[model samples]
Target: MKTHLTILLTLSSILTFSQNIKIPSDTMVVTTHTTTVKGANINYTASTGTQPVWDKKGIPIASLFYTYYERNNVKNRAERPLIISFNGGPGSASVWMHIAYTGPKVLNIDKEGYPVQPYGVKNNPNSILDIADIVYVNPVNTGYSRMIPNKEGELPKRETFFGINADIKYLAAWINTFVTRKSRWESPKYIIGESYGGTRVMGLANELQNNQWMYLNGVILVSPADYKLYNTSQPVYSALNLPYFTAAAWYQNALPKVLQEKDLLDILPESEQYAINTLMPALAKGGFISAEEKETVANKMAFYSGLSKKVILQNNLDVPTSFFWKELLRDKSGYTIGRLDSRYLGIDKREAGSSPDFNAELTSWMHSFTPAINFYIRTHLNFKTDIKYNMFGDVHPWDNRNNNTRDDLRQAMAQNPYLKVLVQSGYFDGATTYFGAKYTMWQIDPSGKMRERFSFKGYRSGHMMYLRQDDLVAANDDLRAFIKNSLSNGKPAKYEKD
Candidate 1:
């Protein structure tokens, strides 16, 4: 009887212990390395870790993975600035920005940005680490970050962190925890967001400031998805896409000889003017516009874009990217222009289709960046985990409810007078065209008194401009200058228009 009771008590204790083993709040692995940048030897510490994000009720909701790098031998961390970087996809991990562009190491790709054979990585001499300490954050459901699954292996509760505002909430929590943990509250903070992350940055500026009482020094928006300037329907959508259309056509040498010889900048303003003044009004009028006027508009659009006037008129003078990409180079070789980088071409079985079968540019780099990051994590950073790294996880049913971040950005600028903004765009990026970014920034700061605080730069590459070596150098130089000016409380230097 005594032996039986002892066995039952031991079994119960084991069950309780198994049930009480909670997920770890953080798992950190630190490594040190040295790299040469511009003939200067720099040593830095790379911290690969996961930080827990708890809910308002003190319940652990998600674990966010992050890579933090700080220059070694720095006497005062308080004087150093911290840049938190992320890529956008609503579901994307930070690997895109980490292994491909800004991080100390970049994928060894060709000059044209094609991944090299045997897939590897190399030191990025232009890495922004030379100036500021950077932390690449992978939000919940991205990279190794995930929601704690229940006993049934279902992630029902983690769905809340997948939305726009909820993402901001948890991300803010993680950043707060990191800053507090690292003891760098006095350091100037910056946010570097690419694509959808750009929208996140704007919301974060407001959320972090209002909720967490953390002030930011500057924001770097790369290929920003400014929904305020976005429209899905015809006319407005096409109008918004006009400059990009012109850019692609120019790149493919499909534009008329007169426009082809002209510099891209000269053509962009014309496209913007036509888009806002002519195309928008005509599209808004709908049936009210005369056929003659529509014919004239179509002819002008054809001249700027490579599409025929008949095709433009058939589409109601509104050529969405889907149709334009297929139609622009269709006559020459039956190939479709890439939506991300127009320089890339794709061969679709059905060339007559409205949209290309796939985005050639997006797929081209995935094979390289995906493997390179995985290799770097396990091999160089010495961070090992059984969980598969999710480069772009499926954060489905992502709620966009009340996600107007432009207002949040405006509010941040209004409240924080010293806060500056650097808006960058790749002229060849069909996603977030340069003119669209310019329009949004123009609308954001109309007074022009803050003009010194705002700088708009255009790159010669696609959405991920830094993938191009020259653009990476340019971007790095610009960022270094921006950081210097921001830390000194001086107005950011103006970027000469491209």
Candidate 2:
């Protein structure tokens, strides 16, 4: 599922690939190395900070290729703070972070998130740079980053992503170089990670605290995954997914009732409570129910799940994901929509015959980002590379299993008594669903008081809700408030921007 979220549909051929970028003679292509007991492998390049990229639209960006943006130039005016940010795909570029949150160029998203003109970047007056210097890193094989030539296929995919300990061991070595070279040892540090990066940050905090002897100031998790629920190990995962199904159904009006209510927070809890308290037991009964009785329950379930009764009962209440994709619109040429982003519902009405849902439906949009991002990078940020940026490179093969690092959570807070957090979720996001983050946080910070150290807000948008103008403004203001309150009293800031 994550692979699909990050995959690019190469078949579309929407844009032709440009030739390798020429490395200038005067420009030195530098390499840095870090060694782990696992092996000495990370590859990196650096540039002394330079120019502007763009004003946040499709407009031309003006930074020299390979130059780093020296956020420290304009000191915090008090103390120095360094915050590292990255998006999780394990394969996604930090573009979302750069363009949407910290970059000089920002898209003017609409209230409903339909893009409009004057589509340019903003100065990000609310940026944390007012409080800290932010550095965005693209993980290996994603964005303009790629595995060094010899190291390209040297390591198997599994070795790179599996075994939480292995991952942290390798990642820390790489990240340390960036921090060390920039002479940020004296600066208070923080990390911001989204999705898998969120999950990864926990372990990273542990390593940074214990191994690197660096205690972090704080960590931010946006739409994170707590593998305990996200992984396939739990049979109850199917059970938990039901509420999200209802949440999705409610938002899309897949439920029998129009559910005209505008906000998901208003509806999801009720439906979620119903699923846990009643519906789950009914579905668990399985063959005990008579055909007629089964049909009745199925209809009700469908009503709640935004699916059809016949389709619901067909698979013994284990209706496949594809059913949700196409069943809703079976009456409309079998049109199916994205489970991740419902924005671009596609036409795939033909019979899928109980087979897996078509994967390509969601890949196109993410793929579209590749060319667009490349164009912007080349034309604006003069930093160029010969490497083929893998928008969704499967650097590691997932076993479709779960190994949660929720315990690593407190190690972060414990290490840095000063750390505070804000977690944001999109009601419609299927990738790292809201409840999943809740479940993990509940376990991690069981004492509601410490848990209160974090504030979780819901958005009407999906995984990338920041793209929507309303959400973007809300997020900017909310983050600004967080920094403001944190700086003022060293307390967690609270804001509800649903």
lDDT of each: 0.80, 0.55
Write down the lDDT that model 2 would get. Answer: 0.55
lDDT of 1 by residue, 1-498 (tens): 001110001111011113354324466778888876666777888888777776666655567789998888988888899999989987989987788677889898987788787887888888888778999999877888877644455554645787778888778878999999888899989998998898899899999999999999999998888755663344565577787888889988999999999998888888888888888787877878899999988888888787899898888876777888889988888988777778788889887778899998888878688889888888788777667788888788887777668778888877887688998888888877877788778877666756778898898888988888899889888888888878744454334445
For model 1, the superposed segments whose C-alpha errors exceed 4 Å read 1-25, 150-159, 231-234, 446-449, 488-498
lDDT of 1 at 448: 70
lDDT of residue 85 for candidate 2: 76
Put down candidate 2 lDDT per residue, 325-346, tens digits, no spaces: 5565556446565665454366
Clash counts for all predictions: 0, 16
Could you tell me how far off, in angstroms, the CA of residue 491 lies in candidate 1 after the best superposition? 11
